[model samples]
Structure formats: C-alpha cells, structure tokens
Target: MAGDGTVEWGEDRPVRLMDRLFGDAGGGGQRLSAPAAGAAVVALALFIAAELVPWMSVTQQQQGIGPDLPSQTSDVSLDTVGWGITAAYYLGLMMLLAVVGLVQVTRPHTRRALTAAGFGLSAAMLVLLVGAIRRAGEGGQYGPFDQGIEATVGPAPYLAIAGVLLVVAALVISGWRPVMATGHRRPAPADPDEDDDDEEPGPIDLTVTPA
Candidate 1:
C-alpha cells in the first residue's frame, strides 16, 4: 500500500526471481503434510538404498573339456551408483529438488508441479530399470566360452520400483483435499426486546414545561 491508498506491485529484481521460482511469500506457501512428508522420506531412503545395492547379476559358466577338468563359474553384479551413475545422479537431484520445493515453496501450483515432476522422474527410472532387466536377460556369448551368460534381476530394481510407487503415494496424499463438514445449526433469532434496549434515548426535554 502507498500513501495514496493504492496497492503497490513493485518488487526488487531478486525478490521477483525468487517469487517466480519458489513462490510468492504473500501467498503463504504450501508444505507437505505429515503422512506425505513421511512417504517422501521413505521414498528417498529407498532410492538411496537401491543405488547402493546390486541391480542385476550376470553369471557365466564354462564346461570342462574332459571329466578330469573342472567347470568354471563367474558372477558379475551391476550397481546403480557404480554403473548407472548418470541416471542415479539425475534421479537423486530430482528427489532433492522435490523435497526442497515441498518444504520451501509457498505456491500451491509450484508445489504440485514439483510433485508431478518427481513422480514422472521416479516412473521413468522404473521403466528404465525394467528395460535394462529385460535387455540383461538377453545375454550374449562372451570370451572363448561356448556357453552363454545368464542375467538375473536383483532386489535393487524392485526397491527402486517401490520407491517410485511411494513417490506417487506422497503426491496423492499431498494433493488430497479433506471434505468440509456441513449441517451446522443456524443461530437463534435475535430478541426484539434486546434490540429495543440497544436503542439510544434521544433528546432530553430542555424547555421549561408547566406541569
């Protein structure tokens, strides 16, 4: 408000930028509810754990030339953080940004957008994991061994999928609007006597009157 009683819309450059990115402070930014916050935390933990754990395992077997010679077996495990660093980095970044947005952003629309983006990223990760697992299953021959390799999907991918579902759950929980209760009793009618009593006594007779 200005001295002239008109509303002022001017803002500093940084403040404008902040409002554009995070949200308007005057709007009273949205924050995650308890259940939604818990779900998000769990999802983040699951994603981190998934990155640490082995996502897939490949086993190679070589048959012995003769009965005297022994067969050889080797195993290779793929980890998200180790082999899929790029994907993990992006997913982690998205999750972090989502958490930050949920906590700090004031605009409901901005929060919703962040939640949607997080859910999309999580779903994309799951899809990539499924595709990778399927591709791994179609193993090719390696080295001089005639026998081909076998690939098995590991627990890490499933954990990641679980995390993705949780992310969606969090988003749903956050956006859920509670139904407002109705059927309140109306106020009782105002007393006419009370209204009469509220009236002010006006104009005392000041002129000299003969009784």
Candidate 2:
C-alpha cells in the first residue's frame, strides 16, 4: 500500500521508471509519422545508390615540349568501395542505423537515445562526404615534368548530400524520437455497478410475514 491509500504492484516501479526515461509507457509518446517514415525510406535508398555509383573522377594528361612528342590522357573513376576501408566502415554503420530506424518507425513507441544516435551518425557521414569533395576539388600532379591532373566530383556525392538532408528532415518531422518496445500496461478503470452489487443486503426481513 502506498501513502496515498493506493496499492502498488511489483511491476509499477519499473513502469514508472520507463515512463520517466522515455515518455509515456502506455504508447502515448510521439512517433514517426507515416509521411516522415516514407521520406526516411527514400533517403536511405538514395544513400545506397550513392554508394554504388561513382563518387569521384580523376583525369591525367601528359605532354612534351617537342612537336613530335605524343600526348596521353587517362581517366579513372572511384566509388564508395574505392575510397578504402574507412569509407566502407562508415557506409556500413550508416546502413545499420538506417535498418534500425526503419524497424523503430514501424512501432508505436519511441526511444530518445536511438533517435539522437541516428542524427549524430548521419551528420558525421555528411561531414566526411563534404570533406572528401573539398579535397578532390584541389586536384593533384605527378611526375618530374609536373604532368597535369584534374579531379572532379561525381553525381554520387551530391546524391548522398540529398539523402543526408532528407534524413535530417525526417528526424525533425518525427521530433527526433525512435520507436521502442515497453512492458508497461495502464490499469483498467473500475466499474461502479460492480462495486454496488458487492455490498451486503441490509437486514433480511425475517418477520414471519402474514400466515
């Protein structure tokens, strides 16, 4: 029994704790709206496409001062995989986060921690992508003759930027909350009719009525 004259069940403590940490435990917390979830799905799809397509293009040209000298040009393209392990690892992590977010979107409750994590990771990925573009724009040179080399940003990087923006929009629309499962159940309301019926009858008229 509680000081308020109410009985406290063994499960009440944990329920209250969960409610305090993650909003209403009875599934009343804000969730990812349908339209927002759709946008997130599209964003994830764009990110995947970005990984598969070329992100950068490199062109190398060689020329000699002599009129008889022959000139040569070569072109190379690099995708997410071509960036090496660091880029690959980041892509994998982002994909995993996307999957988790999708699962949460399907549920009724939301977890604040997961939502915050998704936002942080997505933002980090965007930063890395932008940095890669900036470095590529500077270009590079090779050989003693200083052979000219030009690096150009590909469509894939731009696509990734779009995806990241969409992800931000989705998170904002959903209020930065991810769905989570909880064991809390609201107590059922009492029935007044049942309470009245449970009362004992006053006095059974035992006066041997008229014979």
Candidate 3:
C-alpha cells in the first residue's frame, strides 16, 4: 500500500482516447466525439455521387457550324441509366450511414460493422460503376468502375440495404455498453469490505480449545 493508499500504473492515458472515448461526467467518463466515423459515411456518399454523376444524362441540342447546315437535338442515355439509379439510391441511403457512422465513431464495438458497411458500400459502388460502364453507349472516354446494370432495383432495395447496414452497425456499437434507454448502465455489484485489504480483522481469543 502506498502512502496515499492508491495503486499507480505508469501507463499514460491517451489524449485521443480521453477525448473520444472517455469524457468527464462529474461521477464517471464516457465517449465525447464521433467525427471520424461520420467522415467514413460521408466518403461513402461521395463515392456514390461520383458514380451517379458519371452515369446520369443531360439533354443537349447542338447548332450546326454553318447557318445552312441546320441544327440537331438528341436525347442521350448516360451509359448506365440503371446503374445511375442504383448510385443515386445509395446516395439517398446516406441518412442511415450517418447514424451508423455516429455509432461507430462514438463506440469501439462498431469497428467491425463499420468496416463491413464500408466494404459493402464500396463493393456496391463498384457494382454501380461497372453497370454504368456496360451501359456506356459512347465507349470513347470513360472512368473505370461500372459497366452499368440494364435493370435497376430502385430506391426500395437501397432503403432495405441502408436499414440492414444501420442495424448491423448499431449492434456492433452496442457492444460498448448496455443501455436500457433510461441512460443507465445496466448494473454491477459493489465492492464489499472483505474485498479491501484495509478492512479490519476481528480480535482473536487467547484461549485455545483442546482437541
């Protein structure tokens, strides 16, 4: 026992850990920030946009260089209409990703699900990109990724995926602690006097019993 009756472990508490996972709360500590996880979700969204933009179509009418030449207006399909829809759907799913990211950034348990979501999002994005590429009527200049899907699953599939991802992320992050919605950490047994070395021992009798 030290003079102050406290045990000291020389390991320094990490500053980042303190700021992100352990903030002072009068009586205890808890996580404070979750920006990194949020960034991951944003990145996924941006990637989706990249794919969608490349696949979305724009109407254009071009005038002939010579006045006699006349003008032409044409409706164009931006490679993969279906893949573009898919990408846009994923983009819309950002809301769920936001929640998942927050959960991941605030707690460590979410690491797995976050990683998994990231992987799934990335793969989906790639699939969208590829599907878009395949739909590319103009094979001249193009970005590598989607060949494009002919048919799309629409917003519902994306919504379902978003829900699944969020649920997975939530489950993963929930491992950090148990919450009953009342904001209480379930419960734990308290330390008893017997568990302490400073606890006093009862006096012993000098008289001995004969065996």
Candidate 4:
C-alpha cells in the first residue's frame, strides 16, 4: 500500500525486467517495412536453394602402366557433406533466422535482439565454414573426396554465405519502435454515493396496518 493509499492500483502486479528498458512497445501487429520483410524472405529462399546446389568438387588422377590411360573426373555438392560440413549446419540456423526475421517484421520491439541474434548466427556460420575448409586439408582430402585430393570450394557454399550476410544487413536496416501507451495500471473501482439507500426498508408495513 502507498503512503496515501487508495489501494495503490496495480501494486500487486509483477513487472517484467524487459518492460523497464524498452517500455511496453505496444504489442500491436504493425510491421517494420515491406522491403525489409521481403529481404528476409529472399534470404531464406536463397539459403534453401544454395543447400541443394553443389558446393565442392575434387579431381584426382590414378597412376596407370600406360601414359595414355584417362583420369576419372568426380564432383560433389554441398549435400555431399550432409551434416559433416559447417555449411550444412547452417540450414537449421538459417531457418531459425527466418523465423526470427518474420517475427521482427511484425513485432518492432524484437528488432534489437533479433539483429544481434542474426549477427551472432552469421558469425558462427563463417567460423564453421572456415573450420570445415581447414579440416578438409588436414585429412589430405576434402570431405567425401578420395585421399591426396584437393577440394575446390563451390559456388553453392558461397551463395549460402551471401544469403546469411544479407540477413544480417537486412536486420541492421530495419529499425522500428512502437509507442507504448502506458504502463499497466489497475482501474479505479467506483465508490458508492452517500445519497443512495444502502438497503430498501422492508416492504413498507402495508400488511401490518390490517392487523
């Protein structure tokens, strides 16, 4: 109860820590912007497409008794590594980014966190991609390729990287904040007027007069 205490409206309610920083940010359905939303969607699409395309390839020649013997040619795609490559791991991360991006499009309050998350996820992808490449060299052969072979980075992985970068950029550009009307306040209950009868006098002794 407050010092002057007229019941201290809403005093009993809990306040979320986030509410203190950004205020209530009106939880309405307004979106960030059409271009930003479109970019997010496009990023998702590009990521998916990149996953399906070839990302790496390797070639090797087998020694034969005759010099005229032909060497075999082989190629591999991003799907070749499956979950082994960091690029493959990004499929799930990209999906998560897509979901967060969609929410940010509609919920302005989430932009700050969403932008941070996107950047972090992208950075992780880059680190993993480099790790995957390094691991390929350590084994004397890239993933799934024959020994003593050098794997060439393919266009698909590059495409996915580009897509992830775009998502980060899109998030940075989409700035929005909704106006918070007011902090939660309990409504004041109406007080009874002194002029109003508290209770009706028992049905006026009309029946008692006959006795």
Highest lDDT against the true fold, candidate: 4
> Which portions of model 1 show Cα errors greater than 4 Å?
1-31, 67-105, 140-146, 176-211
Candidate No. with top TM-score? 4
TM-score of 2: 0.52
Candidate 1 residue 143 Cα shift, in angstroms, is: 11
lDDT of the candidates, in the order given? 0.56, 0.58, 0.44, 0.59
TM-score of each: 0.53, 0.52, 0.34, 0.56
Error of 1 at 25 (Å): 15
The true-versus-predicted C-alpha distance at residue 85 of model 4, in Å, is 2.9
lDDT of 1 by residue, 1-211 (tens): 1233444545533434323332322345443355665677887898788767666565655555665554343333443214464456466547654654463333567766776676666566666767656544454123223254555566776786787788777776765433322233224676766645233456677888799
lDDT of 1 at 18: 27
Which residue pairs in model 4 clash with each other?
A: 55-78
Looking at model 1, which ten-residue stretch has the lowest summed lDDT?
A: 177-186
In model 2, residue pairs whose N, Cα or C atoms come closer than 3 Å (at least 3 residues apart or on different chains), thus clashing, are 109-179, 110-178, 111-178
Comparing 2 and 4 on lDDT, the stronger one: 4
CA lDDT of 63 in candidate 1? Answer: 58
